[model samples]
Target: MTFSIPNLLSLFRLATAPLLALVFLVPENQNIANIAATALFLLAASTDFWDGFIARRINQSTSLGALLDLLADKLLIVTALLLLLDAERAPVGACIFIVGRELLMSALREWVAQNGKSSTVRVIAVGKWKTGLQMTAVPFLFYAGDLWALNTLAVGVWLLWAAAALSVWSMLSYCLALWRNE
Candidate 1:
């Protein structure tokens, strides 16, 4: 089975997620761990965009590649959320809302598919902004308790609030699209 470069990169990101979690969980090296975890998270997040670009450009898109890419995104996001919660850097309610949005969207996708509808889950522009805010907020929050200035945490909190707003809007957009299609 020949794997494309993008597919290999996705797999690599998935493989590193556990190690990232382990490093973050280490108590003795909190600062270094957070830095490493942030770097790993950024790298994995970048691959999310790069993989799709490469796939479309090279015509190497496959069902497996798509599935792997989605799974990698989930793993990275969920792991980061859990770590942020553990560190108490993130508000529990915000985390709950973010996770709920993800779950609801996943269910909506499955329901649409099961009803014999086209599974073209279009990522909305606002959803992209939501992801960008999250990718920034989670890492900053992870390092909030570190030696960084208090303003960093404050900004991260504000960003998290923005992300939550965007998440809700995106979820509503998905629901509306599904309803309109039906």
Candidate 2:
């Protein structure tokens, strides 16, 4: 509950989720909206890296800060996925796998924590890869256009698909670890 700097960064990311959706609501300025949303998404995603780094560096890590950081990441990514889906930049099936995996993983984490086996479901390498790919994809998806010489939307969709696959892979990895722990 302490208003630590890391927690504040997490809160900023959480708040930016809704604003990203709102950015797309600007009916007349779709180009401007896309640019703004992409910028905001990148900014928020960068905070995901910084919050954890700063927490560890400054010895400000707490259970609350950890929870806030996790929640903020989930919120931001889910909101962006929904936005991409609504705009037709993301495939429906990939979105389903990504979102469904997230829900299942979140529930599994809670169940593990309640059973006093939280470490069994702690973030794995695959999970980190999934998150990194997801964060990278979303901004490109949000832009949905060329960036210099690259067709961002195509790159984004490809990355999103990879992320989705990793989502399933990470979920399976976590479940296996949990089973082994028990």
Candidate 3:
């Protein structure tokens, strides 16, 4: 596949996921490491947003680019969540629920494709909002601690729970759409 600008952005985001996960593996200068990882995550999240916009603007949208974009999003999210789980910063049930929803959605998307119903079983606006919340919360959580008097971790935790609620809503919406053969 030709690596267009949008595709490259998606690839960059995808590459960032493992690096974000591996940051915790380095035990030296833990605070600095976390800061760096959080920066990388934010960068990745920016790419996730920009790539779609760029692809649409440049008329460079491709099947591969679309796949890479989705793949990068999933990788970045799951990687960050797993890392937070490892650090004991995120709730176990929430992490598991998020991951499980992602897996189920992926399988549902595959089934939709097999039945020639692409994008019909895809994420809804609530799901996109859930993703936005997740993208916002994950960095705050990664940089867990305080900035000035504000408790970053507490804010992130609350946002994450809201994101989780949105996740369930969106998941059910998709399932209902599929069930009704929409």
Worst 10 residues of 1 by lDDT: 143-152
The per-residue C-alpha lDDT of model 1 at residue 66 equals 79
RMSD of each: 2.1, 0.9, 1.3
Clashing pairs in 3: none
In TM-score terms, candidate 3 sits at: 0.95
Candidate 3, lDDT over the whole model: 0.86
Q: Which residue pairs show collisions in model 2?
A: none
For residues 1-182, could you state the per-residue lDDT of candidate 2 as single tens digits? 79998999999999999998898766579999899999999999999999999999999999999899999999999999888888889988888998999899889988988989998988888989999999999989889888899999999999999999999999899999999989
Tens digit of lDDT per residue, candidate 1, span 60-176? 998889778877776777788888788877888888888899998888778777888754467789888988898888767766654444666777778888888898999998888
What's the CA error at residue 9 for candidate 1, in Å? 2.0
Reference-based lDDT, residue 161, model 3: 81
lDDT assessment of candidate 2? 0.92
Model 3: per-residue Cα lDDT at residue 132:
96
In order, what lDDT does every prediction score?
0.80, 0.92, 0.86
- Stronger candidate by lDDT (2 vs 3): 2
State the lDDT of candidate 3 residue by residue for 43-159, as single tens digits: 899998899999999899898998999899999999998888888788877777788889999999998999898867765789889899999999889888788997888888888
lDDT comparison, 1 vs 3, better candidate = 3
Shift of residue 4 alpha carbon in model 3, Å: 0.8
